[model samples]
Target: MDNNAILNVAHLNIKFGGIIALKDINFHVPRASITALIGPNGAGKTTVFNCLTGFYKGGPGSKLTLSSKNKSNNLVEMLGEGFKLQDFINPPAFVKRIYFKMFGGTHLVCRAGLARTFQNNRLFEEMSVVENLLVAQHMSLEKSLLKGVFQTKDYLESQERALDKAHDWLKFFKLDKRANDIAGELPYGEQKRLEIARAMCTSPELLCLDEPAAGLNPAESAELSELIIRLRDEHRISVLIIEHDMHLVMKIADHIVVLNYGEVLFDGTPAEVRNSSKVIDAYLGKE
Candidate 1:
């Protein structure tokens, strides 16, 4: 485990009674970089994401560790405030993990400095674009709610900051004009951008994106590649992406990991991954 790695997942093994899902999986997400996880369908990509964000817990010997540079702290120490470390020391089973979210949920994951977007856009359908972004600041904004309700200076400042962050993301994605429109009403490409922007609003140190380029045309995917790069370079966020878009992955990823049957087949730079015969056989598969 690299001490500096923002996320270190090691020895992760999951099973369903008689069937195994993931076996001895291990990976690290470096700070302020883009690492792509690519594989075919049922390759255990989403299962990996679910486990990291606390939606699904692994069976035994599963270790998912997150770190922070501030005071060189471990997020497990401060996050899930008022909750004891014992609670997460041993996570629940796969089914119980789903119910855990209803209480602590992915929002707890967000507060821990990791946030994710689904392969399918998971937005508040009826909420306006900006509203969706604002809602993602659930934890931060809630702390100032009373002041906001009274329009006090502290809350007003907090609200302004949140809105400013939202506007910046919207502008970056070229969707400032659609900020007031209902989220679901937007076209697919714009909706994709919105989803990324919404995740950005949470101020995550590492953003996990699942198949962000799915359904996007070449032009849109190219632009998304640039956006992802900008997120890493400009916004200072590390990215762990599970995407099938090889072109986009090759374009923006600093590191790439190829997964086959829930285990890592290859892990290296874009050039290395692009040139690997093993990856070709397991994932790329004869062009």
Candidate 2:
């Protein structure tokens, strides 16, 4: 865990029965930089994201660690030694231990300042836009829950602060006009923006977005690209994006990691990746 790196994935491997999904992948996502993962379909890109986000654990020697200069200790170290992938992927004898570790992983990751949004827009359909943002701030609100239940003065103050912060993010995403609208009532593009806004409300040091431009029109995708760049330059949040949109990837990525058949075909700046023969072969195929 270097002071400069936000996320470090080393020797990661994932196997489903006899299928080798990912093999010996290693990459570092630097602090405050935007990195893009691009490859053809079935290239194990999403699997890598799953492993990083704790959705799926890797095999032996698969180590995923996150380090933040503002945080006191390494999140991986706190999780303890020998936190192997098999222990997480396969059912272990101690279900509770695994559960604790999984929750701890997410908590430490978020606490270490990381957030993410899925490819499919996930919102509280019944909740208002403001409610959705507020829900995403649960970690911050936890400190006041007990006090608030007792109607303590501090609880009221904390509630007000959380509301203000939520409002600020809504404004940041240009969703202030729909603050009281139900999340599900918003248009597709607005929902996508709300998802990003919700993740931003978490105050993450690093944000991982999965195919955010999937359903956007050309104009909307352009706006998404601008929003991503703004997040990097203005908010200073490191971003790791997994997208299939070449135009969007090229527009904002500081670096690119190209995968092919579960292996690293290329890793470099956007210009290098775009020019690589291997990337071309992987995506466009050889003549």
Candidate 3:
């Protein structure tokens, strides 16, 4: 693990029955930096995101560790993998593995300072924009049943705070005026921004975006590029993005990882990726 990395992936291997989807995939998202994962369609880019966000589990010896706020979590372990050799020697780790096996889930991953948006917009279509954002904060909110039924002061205050946070992000994304409108009613570009805003409301140290620029026009993609940079510089959030928009990736990525047939073909800066004959021949040439 890099001392400065917010997320570290080592020896990641995924299989759907006999088909090997990802083999020994490894990378790290540096703290407060933008890292881009680029590849052709069916290159297992989204599979990596699914694994990171806890939708899929890697095979044994595949470790996904998230480090932030002086705490570290083994995501694969949290998703119910048993003890490793190291855990046997480390008492705390051994106990945590037991706890995760009993109580761990995809929701736990979000609670562990990581949040993500899907490739397709996964907004609550029938819900209002503000409602969608508030829902994202549900895990962080206190859920005392008695207080909620009685409308206690503490419960009301917490709800108010959640709403304030929701609107804060809505305003940042320039969706404040549409806060009362249906999330599905918003324009496609605004819907994309809203989804990112919803993820931000979770207050994650690391944000994973799956092809955020997929449906945007050129101008919208340029704006997204600027917003991603701001997310790193202004909000101090590390981002891991899976994107096909080479222009957007080259413009904003501090580091790039190129994948082909579920294997890493290149890992370097934007300049190195641009200059690599292997990357050029494999994917960029087709572009």
Candidate 4:
């Protein structure tokens, strides 16, 4: 691992039955820098995010190591190399298993200081904006169920802190005025920003965004590009974005990686990628 690397992915492979999704993927997100993954549709970009978040477990030998606050976690290691449907026969055991998978699954990755947003806006539709943000901090907030149930000072302080953090992000995203509104009532662009804000409330070392610019207009995309840069420069958070918008990618990403057919097609800085003939050929549908 590089001294400044926050996330490292090596020997990553994912296959859906007979179909190859990602093959031997290797990359790293630099500390406090924005890295963009760009490729044509179905280039397996989102698959990488899915693998990183534990939604899709890659085959054996695949590894994703996240470094945060001087601690490192190998996501693949936390998830053992086995899947047993038999362990879920009993209802009580199955509920426990499901909770374990939910809490220790992506929560393990998130607790390791990584957070992610989906391609589609994933805000809690029925909850208020601030409430949605608060829910994202469930792991840290409810660390002590007894304290919360008794309404102890520590729990109240923690709740206040969580609410403060949520408001801070809402202010940053210019959604403070809408903090009391239902998340689904917001405009599509605002919902996208709210999702990112919710992720930020988790205080991740690295934030992974899957096509954040997907449904936004050009102006909104430009705002998102600026916000992403600010997240790296001001907040000191690393970002790994999977985006098809070349304009936004060039504007925000310090490093760019292009994938095609489950393989790395090109890896370079934004300027280098812009000048690479191979990248041009790949985008142009050439060999």
Error of 3 at 186 (Å): 1.4
Model 4 Cα lDDT, one tens digit per residue, 7-47: 88898999999999999998888899999999988989999
Clashing pairs in 4: none
Q: Per-residue lDDT for 1-287 in model 3, tens only?
A: 69799999999989999999999998888999999999888989999999898898887778898997579987887787866789989999899889888899788888888999999999999999999999999976769999999999989999999999998888777889999999999999999999999999989999999999988999989988888898899999999999988988999999999999988889999999999999988865664
> What are the per-residue Cα lDDT tens digits for candidate 1 across 1-287?
89778999888777877878889889999999999998878889898888787666665567677775353433322222233355566565433444543465555667778889998889899999999999987666737557757888877787788899889889999999998999999999999999989888888898999999999999999999998998888888999999987888888999987788978888999999878899878754676
Top model number, lDDT: 3
Question: Residue 6 in candidate 4 has what lDDT?
Answer: 91
lDDT of each: 0.81, 0.83, 0.91, 0.87
Q: After superposition, how far is residue 48 of candidate 1 from its true place, in Å?
A: 0.5
- Per-residue error for 140 in candidate 4, Å, reads 2.2
Name the lDDT value of residue 61 in candidate 3.
78
lDDT by residue for model 2 over 91-141, one digit each (tens)? 663464555565655555666677888888889999999999888888777
Error of 3 at 22 (Å): 0.6
Give the winner by lDDT: 2 or 3: 3
Q: TM-score for every candidate vs. truth?
A: 0.86, 0.88, 0.93, 0.90
- Which candidate achieves the best TM-score against the true structure? 3
Mark the regions of model 3 whose C-alpha exceeds 4 Å error after superposition. 82-98, 284-287
Q: By the lDDT metric, which is better: model 1 or model 3?
A: 3
Predictions ranked by lDDT, top down?
3, 4, 2, 1
Candidate 3, pairs of clashing residues: none
